[model samples]
Target: MECAFCTDGIDHCHGTLVVHPDGGFAECTDPGCADLDRIRHGLIIDCHAVDPGCGCVPHGSLGPALRRAS
Candidate 1:
């Protein structure tokens, strides 16, 4: 569920897979590959598939998440 984004110092841009209310996981590739700001705000834009067999979803299907209050 958790991903390390950076190889150096306090890894930046880490991401966690968002599970839907139904228990289905959102599209994701590497956890660390997603944007930090997007992840923080739940606005995941890219698919960081954790499993090699995982497939990507269409950009249109990947809806944006609501931004969280800082």
Candidate 2:
């Protein structure tokens, strides 16, 4: 599966779901991300981070790939 945040090949699923009271859904594996805001109304989804060799911290989001600092 392709990650929604980074659009990279997903090796594994995080099995976390953020659902709104109004029937909105967002899935994510990143524990650092706060889904409470999205759960209120909108949906915020986080995906497994892909190592792009940028040498950044291994966050569940694409922090390593998008970081300017190496």
Candidate 3:
């Protein structure tokens, strides 16, 4: 999937999003670009940052996707 910050190619399997106490959000495990931090609260919900386009299957979708990966 395309990185929201860098617009570079990324695999969802290798990506992670972290939410800070200051209501900031960051994408880690992504090299080069600085982490993205949210300026406002509620911009991110449940820390649900990664999406399918980034090649990451949601935890809810993991079972089927993992089965396929196997």
Candidate 4:
């Protein structure tokens, strides 16, 4: 179908579908999207120090909402 990482849906999905040796499939050609996906899945740790400009801090929904309110 489309890249799961593509928040904008198939209309904007530019990644190609890729299948791994384990039969896992993913549509990821964008490096940033791939990194975010990995981080979200806990496959890679978010390095705040290295990417201090990152707005996606992995805070749960409520936490970010509360912070934004304050």
Candidate 5:
């Protein structure tokens, strides 16, 4: 599935973290977010769970589309 976060902003999903589905993760705890449950919308700040094809993969792994593609 495509991440709306990135879809809303091109290349914005790169290098983000990959967060799993968590029922307790609706706090919008990530910085600069709003009062919304990101997981419910298939999203999490700095985490590309919906777009794993990018750099937001498991830790220590080669980040292909990771981090803004500097």
Candidate 6:
């Protein structure tokens, strides 16, 4: 899931978040945010963990289209 701090390119903070399917945060970027969420809700921020991507799109469909358009 996109961090509320940087969703839609908003706050410009960038980091990978590991979110469970049930809306729980397994990892987060911001220090203050991570600490607060961890203490309050048992949310964790495993800095070593990396988020690859949401995998919504298996591959880039735009590449071919853009090449043809150009």
The prediction achieving the highest lDDT against the true structure is 1
Please list the residue runs of candidate 3 whose C-alpha ends up more than 4 Å from where it truly belongs after superposition: 1-13, 32-70
Query: Please, what are the lDDT tens digits per residue for candidate 4 over residues 2-61?
Result: 556565543232333222223243334455454323323312222222224234344332
* Model 4 whole-model lDDT (C-alpha atoms): 0.31
lDDT of 2 by residue, 1-67 (tens): 7555346542333334433223444444456555434332222322333223222323442422221
Query: What 10-residue stretch in candidate 3 is worst by lDDT?
Result: 61-70
What tens-digit string does per-residue lDDT give for candidate 1 at 1-70? 4344333344343344443333344533355565433334323433422233224443345445433323
Report the Cα lDDT for candidate 2: 0.35
What TM-score does candidate 5 reach?
0.20
Clashes in candidate 3: how many?
A: 3
Instruction: In candidate 2, list every pair of residues with a backbone clash.
Output: none
Ordered list by lDDT, greatest first = 1, 5, 6, 3, 2, 4
Pairs of residues at least 3 apart in sequence or in different chains that clash in candidate 1: 5-32, 28-48, 28-49, 29-47, 29-48, 29-49, 30-48
Each prediction's whole-model lDDT (CA): 0.39, 0.35, 0.35, 0.31, 0.38, 0.36
lDDT of 6: 0.36
- RMSD of each candidate relative to the true structure: 9.2, 15.3, 12.4, 14.7, 11.0, 13.4
Candidate 4: 10-residue stretch with minimal lDDT: 61-70
Q: Estimate each model's TM-score.
A: 0.21, 0.20, 0.24, 0.23, 0.20, 0.24
Model 2: worst 10 consecutive residues (lDDT sum): 61-70
Looking at model 1, how many pairs of residues clash?
Answer: 7
